[model samples]
Target: MSVKEVPEEYLSGYAEILAEVGRTGRRLTRDEVEGRRALGEQAAESGHGLRALVIRHLAATRVAWPRTTSPESVLAAVEQAIDAFAGGYERAQRLAVRKEEAARREFIDDLLYGRSDPGRLAQRAERFGLRLAHAHAVAVAAGPEPYDDTHPVTRSVEAALLSRFGDRRILLTTKDGRLICVVPADQEEVVRYFAKQAHAATDGGRAAIGRPHPGAGGVVRSYEEALNALDLADRIGLDDPVLHAADLLVFPVLARDREAMADLVDSALGPLQQARGGAQPLLDTLHAYFDAGCVAAQAARTLRLSVRALTYRLERIHRLTGSDPTDPQHRYMLQTAAIGARLLDWPAKEL
Candidate 1:
């Protein structure tokens, strides 16, 4: 068979193989196989449909089957060429996927960190299904262990989000070992669903949702609020699996003035250090008392103590701090001091 006998458009150098095999009954050389692979890669890189390329090759093979070569030899050569071609095509496709993932990762970093110009960032965001013109809310989930995009919990959360929302202007990604979900502020249900799914999936995990804000900088602010909520939850030993930044706003306000907060801690809790077991026992008592709404029996149950024993501890706290636990005015002072101590991690580390 001559080169002209094969389909011209798709054959490329395939007809050369046929002519050589027809004349010599030889299999494809390594160089010829490599050349075919390179052609496949070029076809892939050029955006030619794989199916179309394969069909073209198959048609050329039929038209240019070498008459002199045994049918078995010709078929074997065709198989080797097709395998190499497919290999190259697959390799190219994988490379394209890796490049795309890298670009997406970079874009996410810039968007979340506010590292790019607002105009440019908003433009880039459109490619990823985000519209920064409207208000957006951020929710973050932190588990017992760090998570990545491929983690089972992360995959489950993504699957859930996609199923419920159908890829609506929602952006979900993992950053700094936590799962972050950003959605339009109006879609409160989406964030709520995410929190539910994330909490359910992470077992010993918790999720925090931040208040909505508008614009590119809003995303950063919401993300930081979610993160801060998580940090506050940990420090304060909050047990709620789903936390809202809005609900926890007071903690941040109370912590704003470091010196004042430190003074409150010293004035209200410092005296507890004089007790037999020191401040921790008294601090635990105060934490439980306030958490139980000053109901002596309930707080006793929480601390696994008799009400009498619990009241004695409260009495000791009152004496040491000069603030009565049952009195409304003194209770405020003690509760605020307790919150400050937790935020400052005082007693464990000097404030």
Candidate 2:
């Protein structure tokens, strides 16, 4: 049947049913579907097709009408109206989901950056099903390469965290190049477990967890600490996939006093600044030596240098720096300076 022959009243009734479904945010019910079919029967009696009626009304209401008609053809034109209604409903749901997700991301970002007031944050948190009262720890996860907030790795990490921490108040977001999460505090084991899972899932990414802090403000503190630990892990070449801020407390402590750390770097390793080559090799050798517990043989093997060559370099460091690597007190001073160098990115920059 042709759409031009359908009565305007019947077409209006079908449009009303679709509008009702849209308003209620639900799929068409069986009764509604049946009513649509009845409308189609009436249209058929009036010598009109359901598809034409639907197309005209949808155009009138500013909804996109699907072009495919064969699928609904088998069920006749009545099914066409139902298909159009379903498509519109699904589209509306998708749009709603996108809006909600955007709002959620914004809320989390504000909370993490301390941009939201406590009262407003609490109210928003309640609406989002997040409990901010619990002690919380922040964790940062990343792959070897930089990634955006929408990277698959970030999404995978979020899913893994949710699987483990769904019952608790948890928030996940991505910033800069890393995935950040806030989870209930004092669950070091759970944090590590998910870190390992994310590492495997992302084909060898790693995570750093921060110490638990109380209250909403603590979330930012924990985030900062987690970032520090992540940075330190990269600088010191830690092999562990999951690192805890508590394990590396000294770095952050040293980091807090930049001036003092810079001075230490200058005092203990300043002589290396005049080395023929850049200071990095000597610094690497020293780090390897100290990391090997001041054992020449182990450090040499680690650096792929012969013992005599390692000894020569050590002697050169002693000659240039006037600090004996073999002397326990001097070794302590040099090791501390090396740590400071790493923290300050010394020699790479003017320290």
TM, every model: 0.92, 0.71
How displaced is residue 321 in candidate 1, in Å? 1.9
Candidate 2 lDDT score relative to the true structure: 0.74
Which regions of candidate 2 deviate over 4 angstroms? 1-75, 126-129, 144-150, 158-168, 234-240, 256-259, 273-278
User: How would you encode candidate 2's per-residue C-alpha lDDT over 188-290 as one tens digit per residue?
Assistant: 6666766776678668878889888877788888888889887888886777888889889987787898999899999889888688896788999999999
Residue pairs with backbone overlap in model 1: none
- Model 1 scores a C-alpha lDDT of 0.89
Candidate 2: residue 226 Cα off by (Å) = 1.2
Could you say which candidate leads in lDDT? 1
